[model samples]
Target: MLAGHAASGQAPGTGPGAAPPTTVAAIQQLDRVEVAGRHYDNAVGSTDAASQGTIRAELLKSRPALRPGEVLEFVPGVIVTQHSGDGKANQYFLRGFNLDHGTDFATFVNGLPVNLPTHGHGQGYSDLNFLIPELVDRIEYRKGPYFAQTGDFSAAGSADILYRTTLDEPLAALTLGQRKYQRLVGAGSSELGQGLKLLGAVELLHNDGPWTVPEQLRKANAVLTLSDGSRAEGWSTSLMAYDATWTSTDQIPQRAIEAGFDRFGSLDPTDGGNTRRSSLSGEWHRRTDTGATKVAAYAIDYRLRLFSNFTYALERPATGDQFSQQDERTVFGLGASHAVDHTLGGLPARSEVGLQLRHDRIRVGLFDTQARQTIGTTRDDKVRQTLLGVYGQTAVELAPWLRGIVGLRADQARFKVNSLADSANSGASSDHLLSPKLSLILGPWDKTEWFVNAGRGFHSNDARGTTATVDPKTGDPVDKVAGLVAARGMELGMRTEWFTGLQSSLALWKLDVDSELVYVGDAGATEANRPSTRRGVEWNNRYVPRPWLLVDADLAWTRARFADASPAGNRIPNAVDRVASVAVTARELGPWSACIQWRYLGSGALIEDNSVRSSSSLTTNLRLGRRLTPKAELTLDVFNLFDRRVNDIEYFYESQLPGEAAPVADKHVHPAEPRTIRLMLQLGF
Candidate 1:
């Protein structure tokens, strides 16, 4: 059975040992409310505007995602796009923040953190290629920094993905698409004696994109799980493994493409990557009449070798500017939370406490390369990072129509680095931070509620940046950066279900960061420094007029800028100004079903001066399906329905070409894939 409240607006199940309702009508009564089983609810009178609400499994199954990570696009006001090969992490944009490789946004799967601190590629690097979309049961997302349970990399928002413990029936699927794409997947679950269950899944995939140099991507993934009991009181253990290798087609200079060069051509064919990950995780939960307790632990072994040549021949003209970033690490973490219900001043109340601890031992390096062969090392370091966090929160019902939540959190992080390039740069650093949070919820009058929220959050800097005393390229002294960057946010919002079969929400939010500063260890330099501010508004609507049809629309607009004046101007580079999406889906319509969606990403400044900007991109997709038999189905997906010509990503930078006299500043972009189609066959037993 699935967890969470029923979509039909029925009351949730009572806790263990509770008396069952006498009649079906009593079970469906809206007035008979139960304590929220999960953190948030999506019923008519539940949820605030800052919450996307719980995305049910049925909805996830109805939507068609081109990439596994694109499933997150269901979160309102978020956009996912890719600039390189499919094996790499997708670029993310939300609430006016670029969120490069998930710097400020946090993501999790089954209580396991996805962001990697002190990473080789970028800070808080997040890769989601290991996710198996078909096994996902629910997605709960929250925006802003208003929750105590969220810690690092959650200043922008956070998402928790849950997978089903057991499948109703075994499944097998095969997909074939344009550009030589192929995939095979199988999953199943079996019940053991005395409430024990076993589940397993495996996937294989390959793809060669439309680039002149084929991507030649090959990926393999597997998962195994064991569980017992219900979600409210249960324990589960899981093991996962993933491996992939691919040839990349990096972004190209617009000048070259306009000068008769093939748009799909690559300047360096050796630019690609290989990565692997294996992990074991376990989660346990216990619930009583008045409270609940939960615990989780995980360990991961990961490695990556990435080759990139973004600048052509700019830095090492002789070596063609190609470089390699290697990372090998082991991560371990533990988390526990306890919640109890009580009375405060004769009013209903709840108190919760949580602790989180994580440690990473890593060997990371950056080296100049030619034809995938290392020429000279820029920096190589062995780093150890440890983080500990504890938090407490209380929720009180001040009045029949009012509720308030107050929280406090403290976090400490320690970093130790051993630099191989320069002994002088090796050192240790530590930092601590405190955050306060508050949220006020107003009446559910006429099926609507208003909310006000404010909070503080943070993200940790790379360990190498925090301990460095000198530059690796030049032996010049350099000041160490702060180990943690702080962020503050406030929001006012409302959620309403005043209309029949319709739900709508709106939020006005603002966020400020102390500084947008980062150390680029790969380049042996530091990024530009500037404090930044962002304000945005989002509107989301969902309508289900009929049992078989659903419609959704989300729109957002933002204004972002630097807080201090500078010669380069005040605009924040790559901070998107607007985004919109609309989707319509129909299912179980006499053996025929269909879905169509449209997404738009507005243009933004590509440089600090705002002198150059990227063009907006719009794409439409359609999915059609037919029920061949009771246990079999076929689906056809058409991507880029209109064959739109657009860019997946754009940047403004200086580069030197083979025949250029000096370096030239120009726009570089990765063109979006054109029209394509995929066919899939699914079988269930």
Candidate 2:
């Protein structure tokens, strides 16, 4: 089966049998090593924290993902769900925080950043619809703010998804499912003369979900990559393009459900979105026995048109409170890093320095809409933003049984805004920040190691918020907010492989943020929130009881609250407290393979006062694959296998029905899909 886990081998910190000094070149070399028959890759010695690891392609290929964004679920504590149409960005929850369209989490594909700093939808908005899972080579993830290579939107964690330069065999696949779902994909690679290789993939998909209005989701995506040489010395260039459009079935109020509304019903059939993106990226790296150097650059063009009506008639009784958001942007970025191996005070050591630069030109607008037609404009603005970050890090063997890592980073941001509707809101601002990080590793006694880490990190806020002085929609006086928010984090963790065929890790961590201020693009205003604090514990285990069977389980719990006192109480709304997942896979059982997975998301407070709460949910998925011939195979996938009646997402807000005299407070929810099945036929040459 495609579902498997690897914990990597254990190595000492500073003894005669200790692992090599950690460096960019060494890590790249490690990644090049083949793991053809291995179920998991060893991370015990190569990782600085127990929470850091890599998921290989062998495992990613076998997992059943209902949506493209669900690929991130393999990261362990992360949960991905959608509240609207399939074309919209997926909502993410991790480490007790509702990420809200990818805030506080940094994501990179082929070294190109995915999070947009000043977006029309929200701050740090990220969309991964363009990704082709079949082309991914591996996913490298690090939790917390402990790594120097990461910068903005990394206060929570970061992930780097690397694509393969070549495919083992060419593939063509077709998938069909219930609700008129259809997909066609083709991928292949060719070796050019003189060590050059070209890889390409294309996908076309359509789905009309189990909704009364019919989603009518249409999408097209493609990727092309060209490369020469290997990890020791190589250069590669890639091009990606994606376009999508869909109708929406947004969340409905509980009152509507009680009034004979279908679970897969729509509040506003006109609510939907269309988006397009294209990018060109290049990367080059050279590695030697003593050092390594790498450089990357990218340019992107993006556009989005979205319409949504969340509160119904709460704000505009005459128009039904519908609004539209539009964004168009061009982005350019460059990054370079160098690492050297040397001796510090007669001890083995490695040092690295890096620089990152990015610039964005954006045109964003908001409008009042009715039935997909614009009525009046709320605000329109042209924004120019630039970001720069520089960092240095060093690792030294302090003792035969101890190792230390230290780093420092500096960041600066500048924003210029030209408000088209209100001249008073046009202005320019700049901000800078300094952060420090430290980590210590001790002993591999009895195949176990302990780690302590502390660091400071940050996320950039929307550029418009740094200059606006009045509410765009209400014309009320407002205060400009900071351009960047800071966060501090610390973790104590351990990893052990004392028992044969079993790997385990445990971590205790805490984090504090200076503020939770965010710019609401939908409302055309800034909402300042109080400071917040959070603490959590996690345990992850992988065991292979037999050569044919693999079992993996992960559990996490967190406590989240506002740092300041208030009459409304300190509970941080939507901060889920518990999450768990279990998976079992059986492989090499003749020509048949099978996998089963269970996921749970615990309830959380819905409001600050804790007077209301959301419900928990549990769901299971199943997959079966059979080999039909040497070059052909068939597979079946089942989603929500038990047909549980649950919600994908929930919110508490005020809205008014068609005949209501006053707005009413109630819970709004997007129900999870019922049991569905899909079948696929794959051919390889």
Candidate 3:
């Protein structure tokens, strides 16, 4: 759930129960309709900042995504890549931050939060494997902490994905690709009478990746929803279930690959994971002339069993350094908000207030393992974590050309952890924080607008870390960490549609964190680090030169460093400095459509010191589609269109080989999938 107008202003999809209108061209009752896209979606006056906008479903469908998480790449400056198996959470990078497993970023589907707190693998572990892209209607996104509606894990940014309540037609699709990749999906919506509609979707997939050990991945996912009315006056309930299992090929040391090992080979073939998630959620919305109200509630059941071998034999030469992480949890959440439109001193104004609550009952553990068998327990804990946030904001038209938005948020967190193995490490604690936000919007002159936004935000540390007193592996005293860390950010931006058939924006932003403390879930401890600062500039553009052609380009550059003095150099590890993307799409070209895109990931420091740096990578993807009949279509997708040799992720760390006398420091890399092809036939009934 999001904050009120006072906290974040009148952002898209933030007004009381109101969703942003389609930004692209509207549908026509002709033989064919031109699909909507960001290029056509105008945001000049509707958005509070240049960095915030809606990505339409048409744009999502036009792109070729190798994984579910890659969908987030649609957000400018964000990169999504996998370091391990398909079943695991994808690594994310944004705004000069290596948002490991969803840290400092918030994501929501419909109204259910996707980022899990106190997770076994990592804090705020967000797994989007259950997402069905075709079912998404639109995605509303915002960056920084200038919004009250978003509370935690949002210091960098947040995205809220909305699902369509109904479909234009029923769909059935089958896809087959290289490396034994196969998939089947079916989705449809039906009228249930009396303003009630039912939507259902299901997906089944299998793939054996291009690894020597074979990444035997399998998945089953489904979603069902019942809804009545529209966003301004409606209610909906949904049920979702997803399950996945896969054998993974983790990153291999450069020395091993140079020593005659296959680049795609795995040092530990047994490394893999299994995960399942099921949830029930409901939402209600009502709107009138002067006021509106909305409420959302959800319950979720989730479980995960993951085995990884990152350090090889560095610690346990006898049996290798393999380990297992197990997590099982039940989560409950509720949110409610109300907004009123009024007049202030003869000026038009709007105010809103909201409350959000979430609780997680979790059982999590870390263990030493051989193959997939647990040999020893590092730590086992039962955690109960609760979060409560209340926020309010107001938007006012101070003058003919000036508008202002201000808000405040209060958050309270309670962490209760019971260390099953070490009572000395268990404790209960609570913390609270207050955040304030402000935004100023000036002008719509010449189809352009200027914006200034500033805010304070916070992210919660792991509950275990907030209460731990001793390290589980080493019998040493440990210092507890703050339950909450604060962050401050500001942005100066501009959005314009001054050029015909084009929408472009530019933003200059800066963010500072009080501390870079983090919980090391793999070892069940906290890593206290230094304060940091990040600054960046982003430029995004979209153009439709013709009714059937769309072109888009976006570029971002960031400078990140530790704020405190350190001999290890001030550079932040894995803080990407540059990113760029270009895309061209042609649709309705006489029953044929095509799209091509190029993405670039610039080099960055691999460690605190800048001596070791990663290499930049560029990749291209292409999609071609044709209509077979009024009800049938065919499509072909090529990933890594140029067959580029590149790595998906890279890290510098210490590890030991089976016969090595001692440990060695080297670069570990997971190679990106080579050129691959997929073909699909879709039928509408």
Q: Specify the highest-lDDT model's number.
A: 3
Q: Write the per-residue lDDT of candidate 3 for residues 1-685, one digit (tens) a residue.
A: 1212221222222222442211111111111112223422335555677788778888898888999888899888888888898899999989998899998999988667899888899988999989999898777788899887889999999988778889999999999999999999999999989999999999999999899988889999999999899756998889999999999999999999888999999889899999999999888777766677777788999999999998899999999989999999999988888777777787677777888899999999999999999899998999999999998887777765677788899999999999999999899999999999998888767767788999999899999998898989897999998888999999999987777777889999999999999888878889889999999999998887888888889999999999999889999988989988899999889889999999999999998889999888999999999999999999999999999999889999888988999889999998999999999999999
Residues 243-361 of candidate 1 have per-residue lDDT tens digits of 99999999989999989999889999999999999999887777665666777788999998989888898887777998888899999998877766777898777677878899999
Give RMSD (Å) of candidate 1 vs. truth. 4.6
Ranking by TM-score: 3, 2, 1
lDDT of 1: 0.81
Q: How accurate is candidate 2 locally (lDDT)?
A: 0.82
Q: Over the stretch 1-685, how does candidate 2's per-residue lDDT look in tens digits?
A: 0001212110100001111234211111112112223534544555678887777777776768889888888887888888888898888888888888888988877667888888888888889888888888777777898877778898988877778889999999999999999999999999999999999999999999889999999999999999898867888888999999999888899989988989798878899999999999888777666666777788999999999998888778887888988999999998877767788888778787888889999999889999989998888999999999888888777765577889898989999999998988899999999889998877666667788989999999888889999998778999999998999999999987777767788989998999988889888888999999999999988777787777878899999999999999999888999988898988768888888999898899989998989999999999899989988889899999999999998888888876689998899999988998999999999
Give residue 487's lDDT in candidate 3 (0 to 100). 98
lDDT, candidate 3, residue 653? 86
TM-score of 1: 0.94
| Ten contiguous residues minimizing lDDT sum, candidate 3 | 22-31
**Local lDDT at 677 for model 1:** 92
What RMSD, rounded to one decimal, does every model reach? 4.6, 4.8, 3.9
On TM-score, the leading prediction is 3
Greater-lDDT candidate between 1 and 2:
2
